[model samples]
Target: MDLATDLELDHLVGRARRLVVPGRRRILGIVGPPGAGKSTLAGALVARLDGEAVLVPMDGFHLAGAELRRLGRAERKGAPDTFDAAGYAALLGRLRSPEPGTVVYAPDFDRSLEEAVAGSIAIDPSVPLVVTEGNYLLHDEGAWQQVRDLLDEVWYLHIDDDERVARLIERHVRHGKARPHAERWVRESDEVNARLVATTRRRADLVITGALTG
Candidate 1:
């Protein structure tokens, strides 16, 4: 779907609703660059759905802050390799073929603490749908492709470039970065990653745009 003028986000969310089999779970993934409003959309969809749904963010797979610092990748924390991509893929594979009476625990990222906390969440097979969101979910190369295959369907959220950059800068400031530093980071680092993600847009099963209320 061409998010710009084709199908609306609500339509996609409704489709996801149908994938929920009463006894089994479905995994739906949302992929987009920073400030694309993916988190907001995911939250809204989960809220709209009447059944059980969980948001298992891929951010949870991020390497610990200390580990990133140790590897000299602290400055590029959101880059693909900074996360435990392979481990996340494994989790999704397990989620796909869950065992009876077994519960799966997953890690979650703590923004305030800037670290990944293990066993932060439990996924019960009865939940029906697990909605995971991240920047690299649709990426074609490396273990990212495994992520795409694992998801029953993938949605790419698209937003205007100007608005996206503005939102990213605001996010940095809200997270304690100085204005100039935030702008520089958005231009130099975030935008670079955004371009890489743009190339993967074609991989999405659907695309969403505008605000959640729009």
Candidate 2:
């Protein structure tokens, strides 16, 4: 890890350690625009926590590609309406209340297939924290509001516009979109969603501006 990432991990670990109780689960939500490194930060934090935390990403709640196509939303797949916001909120609620010896399974997003795989993540009841990273955790409208309510704390990752856009384009290309198509998707679809997410930044408990260099 780079110095910046080390510092960030230290800060997050300090804050998260305080939330730990002997028998209760603490939920941490990391929210940011596409390509802002929410998942990178969350993964680092969870690894540092050393098995005490489990990751349950909100990407798992994305509507299936088939479903998106059926609803005529495939072109704008990352929009707020393309997710099962209510189901995501409900899962957060479940993660917050764990029964002894019961393992909770959460869906996982498979980027290669562009689909959500059910029961892909297992959260054992012994885990004390759940680190969930996503683009819309702080979105206020509809069932998304409940998602904000279910978390113990929410951190918003912020990145420079140029860097974020570049990362988004690269990510799209890596995920099978050609260079020209990736550029268009970032400019047309991703930027629109990014602007919407920016509007909700004020609601975050912390604004994280660290870049993931490692």
Candidate 3:
């Protein structure tokens, strides 16, 4: 079900709404390769749902740049090993079980700094739904398996390869990378992660395709 039209968005919203209950929290995951518009779709869902939902991105669990550097994984920054997958899963578990009068704080990714900012997002117990998007939510290996198990539903986004690659390069350049560097990173690093994520598409509850424009 592609979220390219208002009717499709309505269907997506309706599905998310059905998961909400009076006293429990439900999580919906948006999984896709980089530049596939996962974040954009997640944001649109949250906006359409208003206060009923909040966004908690998995990018927040990314390992600090220093840590990546120490581990010699700086060049492969988007790989599975570069994130705190266990921590993300634990947070999802907590979010799934809401305690009255308690607020859960989640981390957010600071793209400019290339690091995670702890306690940057507060998920109030009143928020019945959580929309978390990332590249690895549907992945089946290691701690990522736990992440897949924790989500109530996951949707995978698919986009044309040429368009996805073009968007990736533009994104990197907008975020301060030189054009040459952005192209190289997309080809060498992001593409590797994208291929890994593509293998997980069959596991998603729904597959979204089409041009995603925001």
**Candidate number of the best lDDT:** 3
Better of 2 and 3 by lDDT: 3
Kindly indicate the candidate among 1 and 3 with the higher lDDT. Answer: 3
Runs with alpha carbons beyond 4 Å of true place in candidate 1: 1-9
Off by over 4 Å in 3: 1-7
All candidates: CA RMSD (Å): 1.8, 3.4, 2.3
Q: How many steric clashes between backbone atoms does each model show? A: 0, 0, 0
Question: Compared with the true structure, what per-residue lDDT tens digits does model 2 show for residues 1-214?
Answer: 1112232667777787777776889999989899898888888888888888999999999999889999999999989999999999988988899989889999999989989999999999999999999999989998888888899988888888999999999998999999999999999999999999999888888887757543
Report residue 107 deviation for candidate 1 (angstroms): 1.3
Cα lDDT for residue 133, candidate 1: 94
lDDT of 1: 0.84
Weakest ten-residue segment in model 2 by summed lDDT: 1-10
- Tens-digit lDDT string for candidate 3 (1-214): 3333322677777788887776778899999899998888888899988789999999999999999999999999999999999999999999998889999999999988889999999999999999999999988899999998889998888888999999999999999999999999999999999999999988888888876443
